[model samples]
Target: MNLSFTTKRLNVIEIDASSSMVEHHQLTIALPTILTPAVVANLPGYFQGIDSIAAAEKWLANMLNECRLLMLQSQQQEVVGLLFIYTEKHDAHIGYLLAEEYWGQGLAFELLQGFINLVGASSQWHKLIAGVDESNTPSIKLLKKLAFDERASKENGMLFFQLDLRKYPLEEGTI
Candidate 1:
């Protein structure tokens, strides 16, 4: 198992495919309908395609066993969001979504900070990438606050952001 960290209001852990926590995680993802249209528009196609509980379960499972995602749970143990880090040839692509009600709470910052400290310590990756819809201003700003630089926009109109992890390595025992 990977390291799990606790912040003031959250417990961030590496998700397991067979864990019962998958259901709670599904609930968070399913709440997209209650969010603003702009927030929903920020979700990737795979996230929007989960229309049923079974599909959500499968999505969570695949993310765990195949993609190795991390989960952020609230103090009550409710899954509030997920951090997906896709390690590629030279970069680790990151993507995340939080429960609508959790937006603007700085929880995403906490989650990403924990993830960066945890993963950056053990991996060879130095570059982190995230693709955000140009319309998602909050996400773009969040990435910038984390020191991610904006790259060229893709053909699909998604703006890519890159962060050099080498510039922000965590000190030992900080997490």
Candidate 2:
């Protein structure tokens, strides 16, 4: 028989998906809403279809229709980026999209490792998985630092990874 355990932390706040991207120094976290405009604007080559704020807002209006946002807010208490789990079948997918300004600062690992560690300990999760676009080298390196091993890869697509549940207990050893 298989059983999954869940953790309950009272201190964390779940923010709305439609909100502004919070800023902390080099980091600019996108509130769920931020993605739409930023994505629509396709500000950088990262997003290629969105070019207008209206389109961004319309796009965001759609994302908010389905997902919930749980994030690490900025010092001023504004929602930064969206950090939440994407689960399917027996695996949980962990991914986040922060502004390019925050790139290469080691903040991704810091935030991701903390979030995963906080929830992994109490859950009955059998495995934790992550996927990164093959072209993103920095992210590839960061994931390795977090103890995630590559399970498979595609030429120009996302790389798949997995970590043993035993290796990431939220509280080190006990539930």
Candidate 3:
């Protein structure tokens, strides 16, 4: 999807691909330093704590050089999820782990919908793709709801789902 100007229909806020994943979930799709030292220190538990924050930060920063990161942030500026765009290939990858406190709500849909709108406008991208583990039904359901076609099987250790950004416009309608 091609990154373009944002049009918010709900509480969502839209920003450019240059933004960080720091606000992609519940936040306004904007970039903000909401990850405090404590959150950063403990977030490794969320990421399996296999790497240090410094290493992660370096990794994230390096990722920024090759991709665009969009985050979902809450009203209180708490980042709830993340979206990553590999600009060159026009592929989008998401990694969202909502806090246990906010499960069962449709927040992921809201976040992805806006992203679809924003990304679909891009002429740079012929397609947008997401990969999910077969066991991740919630994410698969969300992707299917968005109308991304699933490939025959898994690839690179994950199930691949793709949308022809030129054909399946996110603004077309609700699934």
Candidate 4:
């Protein structure tokens, strides 16, 4: 999806190959602080082992080749995070990372809501799933606040949450 969205405080744009170098630079700076081992503990293995700019570039390239990666840019055009959406059969898996400095200001929530809006308008997906580490209370709280239901628990201290888009209201402020 080549799409872009503007919220009150963010501009989310789907990163394509043309803008990959810029995204690579952003990831190089963001990975050290936001994609640290502790923050990415609950995420999949692909997030780990990235400790250099080249690795960050390769990882970002892989993600771009494999899934839909939307860069979340602040009003000043700084890349603060990314929203990752990948598909498995009929389910859409969602994941994200935001700079530590941008946390707790409700930007993540706004970013997620924007994604929900984007997905709601698309017909290719019917459900959203997220596997958040059990120890990450902030992410758990954020998922719950968005009305995702705890569905199951997996190994590595991961808890899976699901949101059935068929049941999700598309109206504004509903979340």
Expressed as tens digits, the lDDT of each residue in 24-74 for candidate 1 is 554446544433454456676656656556766666666665565667779
Residue pairs in clash, model 1:
none
Q: What is the C-alpha lDDT profile of model 3 across 15-120, one tens digit per residue? A: 3444446532224321223343422332333333324445445445554565565544566655554556664455555444454445568876776777667666
Candidate 1 weakest lDDT stretch, 10 residues: 30-39
Candidate 3 or 2, higher lDDT: 3
Best by lDDT: 4
Report, for every candidate in turn, its global Cα lDDT versus the true structure: 0.71, 0.53, 0.56, 0.81
Q: What TM-score, over all chains together, does every model reach?
A: 0.78, 0.63, 0.65, 0.86
lDDT of 2 by residue, 45-120 (tens): 4345444555545544554454433554444544445454666665677766554444466556656665666556
Q: Which residue segments of model 3 deviate by more than 4 Å?
A: 1-47, 50-56, 88-97, 168-172
Prediction 1 global C-alpha lDDT? 0.71
Q: Rank the candidates by lDDT, best first.
A: 4, 1, 3, 2
Clashes of 4: 0
Residue range 1-175, candidate 4, lDDT tens digits: 5657889999998887677666657756766556767656656789887777777878877888898888888999887888888888878998888877787899989988877877776747789998887888998999999989998568678889998888656566669
RMSD for each model, in Å, please? 3.9, 7.4, 6.3, 2.2
Q: Please give the lDDT score for candidate 2.
A: 0.53
Clashing pairs in 2: 5-123, 5-124, 22-80, 29-80, 40-50, 40-51, 41-50, 121-170
Better of 2 and 3 by TM-score: 3
